[model samples]
Target: MELLHKFSFRLLPPVTFNFNHTRLASLYLSTRFPVSGPAFSDPGPLFTSRRPLSSSVVSKAGWFLGLGERKKTSLPEIVKAGDPVLHEPAKEVDPGEIGSERIQNIIADMVRVMRMAPGVGLAAPQIGIPLQIIVLEDTTEYISYAPKEEIKAQDRRPFDLLLF
Candidate 1:
C-alpha cells in the first residue's frame, strides 16, 4: 500500500527476496544466530573463547556500575539479540503525526523502558518500531561514583529528557 511504497527496505543482499513467501523469509533468517557482545578471540583452530568480552575497554564507569541493573516497571519489551530490524535503518516520522496521540504514547513507552533498563538512550529500531525516534537521558549514576580523574576525563552528568 501507500505506507509500503513510502518506506523502502534496504534489502541486505541477494537482491531477489520474495516478501510474499513467509516460509522462505523465516527459513533464511532462522539459519543465522546472533552474537551480542564483542567478538571472541580464537582459542584454537576450531574453537573461540567468549569469556574476554571487551567491556573492560568501556572505561572506569562501566567497570564500577556494570551496565545498570534492570528493575521491573511499565517498560516496553526491548528487542534483543540483534534482530534483523536492529540493522535496518528507521524511517522518518511523518511531520504531521509528531504530536499525535500514538506518537506521544510511543515516546512515553520508550522513555520508560530506557529509565527502567537504566540505559542512556533508546532508538526506535531498538524496540522494532522502525521509525526515526530516539529517547535519551543521562541519570549521572556513573558520574556520581566515578573517580575524580575519570570525572575529569568524561562528564556524563544528569540531563533532561531528549526526544528526536
Candidate 2:
C-alpha cells in the first residue's frame, strides 16, 4: 500500500510593528506538497519506514527550538493510516470500565502521547486501541508556534482538555 501525506506552505506578508502600537496582520499564501511513503503492507511493523504526518520544516524548527529533544517515551507507536484498527468502528467504552485503572491509564497515556506528538487530537485506535475514546487539547503553547494569520483563518484558539 502507498501512504500519502499532504503539507501546506503558508507565506505571510511583512508587517511592521511598533512597540508603542502593536498590530499583527498577515496575508496567506499556501502551496501543497504531496509526500509519498515507500510501499508497505497494510499492517506494517511499529514505527517502520513511515513518513511523519508533520512537515519537515516544522520538525526542523522544533529541533532547533529544543521542542524535538526529549527522553524516549514508552507510549505505543502511533498506528499508520492503513491499519485496519483505524478503519474499523471502535467498540464503545463500557460504563463500568470508565473508572477502571486500565481506562484511566489509557487516558493518561493518550494525553502524554498527544502532547509528545504535539498534535491537537488523537483517538484510541491511533494507538492500536479499539475503544471509542478520544483526547484533545489546544493550548496556547501549541498555538504560539503557528502563524497568526493561519490561526485566525482557522478560527483556532486554545481549548481546555477534552476526553470522551
What TM-score does prediction 1 earn? Answer: 0.50
In order, the Cα lDDT scores of the candidates are 0.76, 0.81
Which tens-of-lDDT digit does each residue in 1-164 have in candidate 1? 86655444432233565677887879789866546523433334444567654554554364556444546455568998779888888899999999999999899989888877768899988887899999988766845766878777775467888998
For candidate 1, give the lDDT: 0.76
Please identify model 1 stretches exceeding 4 Å from their true place: 1-74, 145-147
In candidate 2, position 152 carries an lDDT of: 93
Tens digits of per-residue lDDT, candidate 2, 1-164, equal: 12222211123345555544322222221322234533332435544447777676777675366557667668887899899998889999999999999999999999999999989999999999999999999999999999999999999989999998
Candidate 1 least-lDDT 10 residues: 6-15
Clash pairs, candidate 2, are none
